[model samples]
Target: MAVTDLNPSDNDQSFRCTGALTIGRAGSTQRELDAMPDGMTIDLAGVDRMDTVGAWLIHRTQRDRGAHIVGESAAVKALLEQVAAADHPVQVRPDLRPAPTRALAELGTWTVEVGQTLFGLLGFFGATLVGFGNVIRRPKRFRMNAVVSSFDAVGVRALGIIGLMSFLIGVVIGQQGAVQLQQFGAEVYTINLIGRLTVRELGPLMTAIMVAGRSGSAFAAQIGTMKITEEIDAMRTIGVSPVEALVVPRMLATVLMMPLLSFFSMLTAIIGGGVFCWVSLKITPATYAMRISEVVPLHDLDVGLIKSLVFGFIIALGGCFQGMLVEGNSEEVGRRTTNAVVQSIFMVIVLDAVFAVFFSSIGWL
Candidate 1:
């Protein structure tokens, strides 16, 4: 074992090494001395035993700092040569790359799986349509308790959130309308604008969104759990159609409650808009009511009720489809539940847009 300090120039800079450069102790020493000034080299000839680590340190030091190793013994040089080879191993090309046909085949398989899932959804909807006949023939067999529970879950539990959201929406609509009407000295008309918009569009749309988040996800998770736990299969074995026992009841519940929820939402939003008009627009409640009476027709409220009924069906159908598709385990239940909510909400929005276009084209607006 030996140690040396080499100075490259008159500057206060040098390299130092101590003891034999073996694999066990070389790593720490290399790290310590690797940060020296340029052109400093540590001699290694006195090193008696050397291994891969010692060789790697020398190789790295030379590569990084342009340092040269001097006075290396045969054993040290042999080890250094092996480390250099290992550090910079020769690259070898594969005998053959993946063929274009193979890539295409893999892509085709993935596309087919996606297509199958979509077709499965279509099949489920078709089956439910057919199952409706069965439900009608034996209506007494349907679980009324479960249906009422689903109704309460979708409608009653959602009232607070829907009411608060509708009120805020109403306030925004009133403020926006008031700004434009105030410019024309017709600020009282803000109530008409807010009422018509809320009853004809926003009320049903907002209520559907609330139910999509609340009841839609619950339906998917409940049915998905049943599927995973073999409860769906048990129901089938006991002469109960899963569609009627689970899905039909939920769908009916949603359809029954959606219009009621929409009506409640419309009332709240109208009240909220009136409040905003009274405070900010300096319009009295009586004047606002008179304006709303003159502008908003009964048909606008009817359109909202019809849209809520349609949106409710869509939400429940989406949720039930995803739930019936759930397989494998608990994770599948969660995955399908999330899919149910997203798909239901998207469907609700798309249908709302379609309704808007249809109604506008028919001069309903």
Candidate 2:
């Protein structure tokens, strides 16, 4: 195209076009437009043909409707008009409500979001239940390998950390109780305190918290990555239900393993407390053992194990739910993973309180 710049700095400054204004010549046109000042007139009557690329450049340079266009054909004028129309700013009225009203409005929005999330979780839970039913009807369709892998991932691999944490907690409880009871000369009751606390509360709660941090986050991260990569979509396309293929085995494995893991945590914690009491408090191992046998009821152990079972369900549900919520990118995967951990821990504590109330009412506490 041939172009002539006419008085580039003045209102009459303009250029004449003589060739196709296509993407091929967009760069050159942009440079010419840039060299001119604002408030110029655009002489487009000489343009052979202008496309979206050319129109966009014209729209950008004009900015505030200061540039007057003297165009040749109907199509070119229409294109320019279409492009320029989009530049008009949308008008939005201000929200003039008081601060309290806005806060309530925001709270409503957040409540709606939370309700929707819970609804999705309930639907996913039902789907997982259906998946379980399908597997029961056709056992061969169930993936034993995945269940075993989950066992290793959530159970066997987690033993060390859970064991260590529980042991230290027991030691702390034992030592603290010993110190306080020494004042009353009831130092022997230190084992009583440790046994009741560990079996009734600390064992299951600590194990569940540890598992939430480890396995729950893993579930969210793994499933979320699969979603972001479209692998979950691929599973659907191949007639595999993601609920069956991904979530059910995890649910089963967690439910099955949580009690066992918590039992291990219980034993380790008792051992740690027993050792501490024996060495630090002059309480013999035999006396500690006898004291626990006489004081801590089997019902307390049952309560903790039952709590662990419920906590397992909560942790798995929270992780898988957050994972399914993920969309778009790796950033979302990380976000949902964190949500999984936080939600699992929160739900575990809430359910623990509920169970505590129920147990208390039933005379089990």
Best by TM-score: 2
Q: Mind giving the per-residue lDDT tens digits that candidate 1 earns over 288-351?
A: 8888888889989989999999999988998998999888989998999998898888888888
> Which residue segments of model 2 deviate by more than 4 Å?
1-43, 53-71, 89-106, 228-231
Can you write out model 2's per-residue Cα lDDT over 38-107, one digit (the tens) per residue?
A: 7766778778888898888777766754666676578888898898787666659875899999999999
Where model 1 places Cα greater than 4 Å from the true spot, the runs are 1-118
Q: List the residue pairs that clash in candidate 1.
A: none
Which 10 consecutive residues of model 2 have the lowest summed lDDT?
Answer: 2-11
- The TM-scores, one per candidate, come to 0.68, 0.83
- Give the Å shift of residue 155 in candidate 2: 2.0
Clashes by residue pair, model 2: none
